[model samples]
Structures are given as structure tokens and as C-alpha cells.
Target: MRLNAENIKGMLLRYIVAIVILAALFTLPFWGGRYIVMLVMLMGMYITLGHMWNLLAGYSGLTSLGQQMYIGVGGYTLAVASTNLGLPLVVGLIMGGIVSVIIAVGLSYLLLRMKGMYFAIATWMFAEAMLLIVATVSFLGKGQGLFITEARKLVTAQIYYFSIVLVVITTIVIVVLLRSKLGLGLFAIRDNDSASATSGVPQFKSKLYCMIISSFITGVCGGVFYMSQVWVQPYASFSISWTVAAVFIVVIGGIGTIAGPIVGGIIYVFLSQYLSTLSQIGSLNMVILGVIAVAVILVAPKGIVGTVQEKFGFEILSARRWLGKSLAKVPVAPAPASEAERES
Candidate 1:
């Protein structure tokens, strides 16, 4: 659409607001306490995970329950690179993403052949198999897991900065992708794969692209998160809880929208931190989280942001491209008269 004055103003306003928010986040460590910094760090990491999952399941119609596999691979890659190969943690982080993409490429041939529940189950099984394999492998520290010794030299603030960068980059990548031709193909496939395929959309290629992109970013995010913890174990790294957290964040926040994960991540982190302190709840925090997710689904099936956007026409971060001006410029033809009216 041709840019109207209102559109221009709105775009400028959004840019200004984004810049201000980003500036504050970048300087948070200098002003915020250690606890707050750590909290935001967690929020960033989960938001990245949530975004990647949303891209796959929401836009591309690929509901994977094995994203944690990439997380584990990335974590182990980082650990081995730093501890055994004597490489910089930064290089290890990049390698994590590359390794994940490689694995994703190999898995896509098999997993992409399946659909719906079968696909989901296959992904989960793959993750579980990887967990067992890593546990039994002697070089990967066996069942004990490997330590990210290089991460020890880095402080919380540094790690927090890394998390901030990762989240920012991930968000940008998603936004850009959604506005591209590939994203259009993804949406078409999601709505109706058969129809999209008939219309000449490369179904397999689009799905594969989405899966590979999701895996690469997810792997990098995992590496960054484990770097903060300074440890990587099979059980912890390959836990199904990672996918569960992603689902909760996306579902509760608004699965398809850009702003859903951000809103959901904040809510999840806040509730998790608060619930963890409740002696009564103890390890049942996950149970409480599950309850809250169910409640959200029941109350607002589209999620908080999605429902609001649907009812109020308010989008916190809209991905729509308006064609109002272009459509307006087109000439409309008059309707043909009926036989009786023409005779009259």
C-alpha cells in the first residue's frame, strides 16, 4: 500500500518506542539488581524458544515435540568445543547452530514425511533416543554429562548481555521472515497444504526451511542458556520440559502473533519465580503452570494478545501488510442490470 500520513506516523512511533525499549534493556545490567538481571535473562531465553516454536507450529503447521533435541545437541556441542577441543565459547555457540541445521536437514527427510500426531510422536521419540545415546556415550562424559568449563570465566552480566543479543536477533529474524515470500508460502501451507501445493507452493521446501531455521536458532539459544548454567547433562539438556515450556509460552501468550511469546514469557517467568518460593507448591510449580495454561485456554482460547486483537482490533506487533491505498486507487466496474430492468 502507498504510505499514508497516518501510516507513516504510526511507523515512526513504533520505531521510536522500540528504540527506547531496546535502549533500556541494553542498559539494564548497569541499573538493575543481579536478581532482576537474571530474571530478564531467563525471559529472553524463553522468548527466543517461544518464537522459534511459534514459527514452526503456528505459521508452518509443524508441531514438533523434539526441539529439545536441538537444545541438547547445541549444549553438548558447546561443551565439547570448549572443554575438549579448546575453542572459544563464542565459536562453540556458532557451531551449535551449524550442527543443529545439519541435524535438521538429515531429520527433515524422515520427519517431514509424517503428519499430525505421527510427526509429533516421531519428534519426541527422536529426542528421547538422543538422550539415551548421549547418556551411554563415554566421550560425551557418559551419563555424567560434560561441563562448559569456559563459561566459568564469564560473569552473570556478560551472560545476560549475550541473552539480550540472542533474543533481539531472533525477533528480528522472525519478523523479517514473516514479511517475506517464504513466510507467505508457510502461511498458505499452514492453512491448507494440499491447496497450497496445488497452487504451486513448494510444500516440502517451505516446511524444511521452517524446520531448519527453527532448529538453528533453538540450538543457539540452548547453547547460550547452558553457558549461563555452566553445565550440560543428557537429562537436563534433552528434557521434554523445554518443549512444554515453549508450548505454554506460545499458547498462553497467543500462538500466532509476534507479541504473544513476549507477553507469555514475562508472565511465565514471573509466575515461575513466584511459585518456586511457595513452600506449599514446592516442585509442583509445573503443575500450577499447567493449571494456569488450561485456564488460559478455557477462558481465552486465542490467548491474551490474540483475543484482544480479535475483539478490539489492537495489535501490539502487527505483521499485516495493508493494501487499502492500492485497492482504493483501482477503478470499480458497475454491475450489469437484470433483463427486466433493462427492458424498463
Candidate 2:
């Protein structure tokens, strides 16, 4: 009873803190300058990206090296739809997600067959192929890129709001999904696929669900990011750097934890920005970031948030099931009578 009460109190406290933080973020643009808003906006996008990647690798055990494929597809879809097809930016955004889902479904047949490094490599190859196709396709602006003139009409504040909403929605979806039956199945598969399969967990279906959700959200994020940039180039959109960034954020923040990506996104955005200003170091900023990641891995192993939770035994966003409480709720069957009692 005491432990359950403590858990409830902790959960309530977490909710309150989350609400306060979200409120501040929503109102930030009103008081904060354009630069700050833009920075936060970028942070939100990367956080969403990290969440999707975490869903795949950390939860579903799908270590994809080519999420950029969805990003590029989303960006290109937005560009073509809005620029050429004369659709609204909102419609284009939706189209981007839809197209990515379709593509994910098609590729899942082949990609899902492989496991480990083979799956990762196949994803990367597919992304590279997409880049080449976009570069060669004349309607996609060939090697140059397409300008999202419509996006230019929207102000920074509006874009910031969009980013904020995306972050909130993405976070909510992940939390709710993690607490559902599908989420339980995903956890099972992540721990051991063969065992999960034997236990009657739908392995392919669960993974496919994760992939589809991740791809759709990632696609939408890509659309929003490129929309903010007002341009989309094949090379930039399809760069492996997207996957690298997601990996760094998740690993540095703490893989398999909801709070990990959020913390990692903040650290990444600020650190990258600060590093970019150091012209003296030139392009060595990436190297510095890599070193930091290595240091974190060596020291904590589980990441900052993961290490903290392990040592302290608490979670900010607790997605784990309370085994004691769960079992307590299940009705126990009466024990069988002893042979002597039965005879009596």
C-alpha cells in the first residue's frame, strides 16, 4: 500500500512538472526572440526524430541505419505536392506521411526478413537508392532541389507552434502506445524474439506496427523540417547524418527510456550550436561530439538518464509495469485441499 501510494504520488508530480514545462514552451515564442524560438523549434523536431528512432531500435529491436529514407521521401513528397501539384502545405504534410507509410509497407516485406546488421545495411542502401532516384528525376529538380515557396510565407512563430504541437503529439502517442498491448508485445520482442514468438506474440505484426508508426512520424517531421528550411535537396534530405544524430541523441540520453531522447535532443542542439560557432576547430565539431558520446558510453554505459534511473530507482516517465500492483489485481485461485483434508 505504501509503495503504491508513493508510485501514485510520483506519477502525479511528474504530470504536474510536465504540464508546467509544456505551458512554458507553448508561450516561449511570445516572449522569446526569433532565434530562441527557432532553436527550440529545431530541438522539437530532433526530439521527435529521436523518439521515432528510439521506438525502432530501443523498443522494437530494429536498428535501422536508413530512417533518412522516410525523411527524404517526406520532404520530396511535400515539395512535389505543394510546388507542382498546387496542394496546401497541410495536405502536403499528410501526403508525406502517407507516402512514407506506403513505402515502408512495401519495403517491410524484404527488410523485415533480415536481422541485425543485414537489416541495417539494407535500409541504408535503400535510402541511398532513393537519393540517387531523386537526384536523377527531373521533376524532383534533378540535382538542384525544389524550393518550398509556400513555406516562406509562414512566419517563424507559426512554424514554432507547429513544431511544438508535433512534439507534444509524438510524445503522447509514444507514451500511450508503450502502455498498450502492442507496447507489451514490442517489449517482449525486444528482449527475446524467439521466446516472444513461442509465447504467441505476433512478431512480424508488432514490428511492422512499430515501423509504420516510426516511418509516418519521421516523414511528417522531415516535411516540417524541410518546410521550415524552405528548400529540399536530395543529398541533404537523404544524408545518413539524420540516423547518426538520432543514434547519438538516444544513446547519449539513454536508450529505451522515454526521457532519454528529450534530454539528448536538448544536449545535442545546444552542443552542436556551440560547436558550430568555433570556426577555429573547423569541421572537428563532429569529432568532438563523437568523443563526448564515447565518454558517456564508457562512464555510464546506460546513458545519463538511464544511469540516474538505475542508481536512484525512479523514472520521470515510468513506462514500466508495476509487477506487484498488477499481480495484486489478478484474482488468485483457491489452493487444492490436502489429501488428508479431502478424506476427512
Candidate 3:
């Protein structure tokens, strides 16, 4: 695509904004107090989780309601590997992701058989089953959860930096994938799997790729989360709230867009914090959040980022501007000539 001067200016503005925001975030620890830094770290964690969910449900058309399966498993894996087995914390964290990947590979065949609601239901059931199973395991604290040993020595600042690193890694991984041919194929499958397959897009493979990538990232987030807290339990790890939070963030921020999760995570985290401090309404934070989500749905069905892009032509994570090429590049077929014209 040809870039006019106006387009060039817009691209520069987007890049500048992105860079400035990142720079501020990375430098905040130097000036911000412990409480503020902790809040930002929590926001980054939520953003990382939300991004993985968006990749699978928003971009790959796999709406899973059992993502907590990975979360619980990852947390427990780290607990066992690092705390019990006496492995390095880093190795344990890596183990968490590896375990999630292995399980996802096996689950993909079964889960991929069902589509839409069926798939969602299956995933939820799987998570529930896992919760029960983990509850019965004697070594994993028997539902009481396990405390992370190594992380006990780490201070708040150290954990905050770890969260920042995780967010950066997740964001970079997502951006790189979205700019590749595989991401284009995944997008095709998300829009229309049958059409994608007809166009040789490898629909199953693309969906599988999304699942593996999403699960691995989510698992890592889970590990980091429990490590920072120094505790992990089945109920909290496999809670339905994880899935709900991810869905709420993505839906409110713009499900299909890259920057949507970041926007949603920030809004959700801050709003939750503010609402919880109110004596009269603190207990009803979920209710308040639900109402806000409903309002967003009614007025801006495409979500906050989606609506803004539609109205103002602003897209922070637009691949078109970043890659200097249109996102969907399907070729136009040539028109057939009439018989009389062909004779000439």
C-alpha cells in the first residue's frame, strides 16, 4: 500500500505514543512508591493473561472457558518443582509452561472436535475435574495449597520487576506472531474456518498453534503470580474468576484488537481497586463491573478500543501501519472476457 504524507504522520504519532508509554512504564519504579509499583505490576499480570485469552478466543475463534486449567496446573507445577523438588525457581517456572504445553497438545485433539459453546463447556468441565483431582493429591498440599519456598526470599520490588519482564515478553511475542504469515492464517480461520480451509489456510493447525501459544503464556503468568504471592491453592488457581476476568477485560477493551487487552486490563484493575475501597459498595464490586460491562456492550458493542478505532481512525496496534502492508491481502480474481471480445 502507498503511504501518503497524512498516513506517514499518523504512523509516526502511533509509534511515538507507544514508545512514550512503554518508556514511562519501565521507568516508573524509580519514582513510584511500593504500593503504586505493586498496582502497576498487577496490571501487567492481568494484561499478560488477557492477551493470551484474546489470542485464542478473539483472534483464533477458540472461546475457552477453562483457561484456569492452565493457571492451576502451572502454579502447582511450580510449587512442586521449585519448593518440593528443590529445583531452581527459573527452571520451575519454565517447567510450568512446559507442562501446560504438553497438556494442551493432548487436550487440543479432544477440544478441537467441538466448536463454539460445546468447546466452552468442555473446557469448563475439564477445569472443574482438575480442581477435584488436585484437591485429592496429598503432595500438593491436599487442597490447602503449597507455599513457594524460593520466592520467600525475594522482596516486593524484585517480584514487580519479574512481572514487568513477563508483560514485555508476552507483548513482544504477540506482536511478532501477529506480524507473521501464521498469524494471517489464524486470522482467516477466526473469521471463517471453512473459507480459510478452502483457501489452504490450515485451519486446524492454526487453531492448534494459538492454543499452544496461549496456554504457555498463561501458564507462565500463573507461575509468576503464585511465586510472587508465595502460595498456591486449588480453589484459587482453578477459580472461574480467572476466565471471567479475562473475558470481561477482552470484551470491554475490544476483543479482536492487539491493544485491547492492555486497555481493558488497566481499566479493570483500577476500577476494581477503586470500587473495593468504598464501604457501601465494596462488596458489590462484581455487580458494579458487570453493570459497566453491560453498558459498554449496549453502547459500544465492538468495545472501547474497537469503537475508538471505528470512529476516529486510531489503531495503536494496527499491523497495516506497523508492517506497511494491509492485514488481509487476498488477491482479486480477473474478470472473464465475453466470447465475442475473446475472439478479437
Candidate 4:
């Protein structure tokens, strides 16, 4: 049997399963309350953002602290478009995404020059610069910031439904990316950047592509989040903690695999909420997170998914022999009486 056929079959099977899961989630907003909706939306953002960050730091080996740069840009862009331009909120949301894309392309040119901790530091500084710029810009209302022109009712049900749809789309994109040929280059880069380059993989192009895609998704999420808040301020809009949340989400869930964020974000979200009630400081949550991260790093360096793979001997990494196993268990056809007759 050809490898292509087997690969196609696997891809098809995954998509079919994904569609069903998404459909089930689409109904959640109708049944759940405002808080539930908020948590789901946040989980989606954290998971998506974590995956995006993972693509850079975990896969492409480009750690960045400035991801919120694009997130903030998206929020501000959405605000401007929805209000002054008289665009629909959705259109404004998309425009925010476009802005983030533009920023990714422009920044990659300069930022890509650095790598390792240097890259991370550059990104952190870039985020700070964004905060400073937003503070001084009068048209954008300077540091004081801008809010949506209108204050509206909760409409939690509607927002909840919207969050469900967005999460579905985001999840689909992530699963597809992980299963595709992109994973080959991504894993290689993660393992050894120099080797991946020498192996004919366009290192810069792959990294840049990841950045653009990651930033675009994060930007869109930021847009939605801005709308959810019904306000946009530079500090909150471009937050370092947003980046930190994403990092922790990926770390706790599993860094390289797509499933990690889903698992990790869900767990972390609940932990934060539960712990927040215990103390005004939420110090318990932080301490627990810190301890878990340290343990996970030591015990499951590959992350939650990695640990699972280890325990179950499931090979998600393509390099592993079993990853190439037949998704469809080919059955041996028994020779029928007619076949025996024909052979005779």
C-alpha cells in the first residue's frame, strides 16, 4: 500500500472526528450561563494563543515574550474600525487581524535576526514599546485608552455562542496544522535549527510563516476579547500576562502537541478560578502553577502530551515508527469458494 493513501485516510478520519466534536460544542452557549461562556471563550483564547506560541517557542525554537504586541494591536485596530469607520463589529474584528498580520511581516524582518534568549528579550521589549506608543498617541486617547462607543446589555447567551464558534474554527486550524507536512519541518527545527536548515528546510520561511499565522489567530482572539470587555485600554490590551498565560497553558498541557493546550488550559482555568476564591491575592493559584510547572518540566519535559505518549507508548512524533502505523487495520481477505474454484 502507498504511504499517501494511508496518510489521507488518517487525515480524513481525524477531520470527521473533529467535526462531530465541534458540533457538540456549538450548542453550549444556548445551555450555559455568562460565566460559563466567559470561561470557554478565555480557554479558547488561551489554547489558541498557547498553540501559536508553541509553534514559535516549542516547535520553531523561537521563544518570544512580545506576542501580546500583536494581540494589543488587534484590540486597538478593532476598536478603531468598529467605531470611527462605522464598520460592523465583525468587520472590525477581522481588520484587527489584518493589522496583526502586517505587524508580523514587518517585525519578522528585524526580529528574526536574533535567536534564543536574544529573540525572547527583543519580543518583550517590543511589547513594552507598544504599550508606550499607545500611551502617547492622542488619536487613540493616549494611555487613558478608548472604549466602545456604546454600552450594551450582557447578551451573555449571544457572546457565549460566538465564543463557541470561534473556538471551533481555531481548533480545526490547529489540528490540521499539526497533522500536515508542516509538522515535519516544525519538529525538525525544534530539535535542531542548524540541521533543519542544512536539510533543505527553509528555516526563516517556516519560522516567519508560523509567526504570521500565530499572530493572526491571536490578533483575532484579542479583537473578540476587546468586544467582550466593551472597552480597550493599552495596558490591558497589550498585556504581558496574556503572554504568560499562553506560556503556562502550553507548558502545563504539553508544549509541542496540539492537545497540550486544550488539556492544560482547561486544567489551569479551573485552578485559577477555584484558587481565586480562596485568597484575594490568588497567591495559592500562582504557587500551585509554579510547582506544577517545575514538576512537569522535570517529569514530563515533552509536556502533558509527551508524558501521555511515554506512558501509553503512543508515538505522536512522526519520527517514531508507530506514528506511521496503519490508521485502518487492514484485514486479510479469506479466499472464498469461488476463488478456490478459479485457482483450480
Q: For model 4, how does the per-residue alpha-carbon lDDT over 126-233 read when each residue is reduced to its tens digit?
A: 889889999899999898788765324436556555556666677667667665667678788889888988998888888888888888888887877777787889
Model 2 steric clash total: 0
Judge candidate 2 against the unseen true structure and give its global Cα lDDT, from 0 to 1: 0.91
lDDT score of residue 93 within candidate 1:
92
Off by over 4 Å in 3: 1-15, 279-283, 321-344
Candidate 4 Cα outliers beyond 4 Å, as residue runs: 1-20, 150-154, 282-288, 315-344
- In the range 197-280, model 3's lDDT, one tens digit per residue, is 999998778888989998888998899888888999999999988998898899999988988999999998998888878746
How many clashes (backbone N, Cα, C below 3 Å) per candidate? 0, 0, 0, 0
Q: What's the TM-score of every candidate structure?
A: 0.93, 0.93, 0.89, 0.84
Task: Find the 10 residues in a row with the least total lDDT in model 1.
Answer: 323-332
Clashing pairs in 2: none
Q: Write the per-residue lDDT of candidate 2 for residues 101-138, one digit (tens) a residue.
A: 99999999999999999999999999999999999998
Q: Score candidate 1 by lDDT.
A: 0.91
Which residue pairs in candidate 4 collide? none
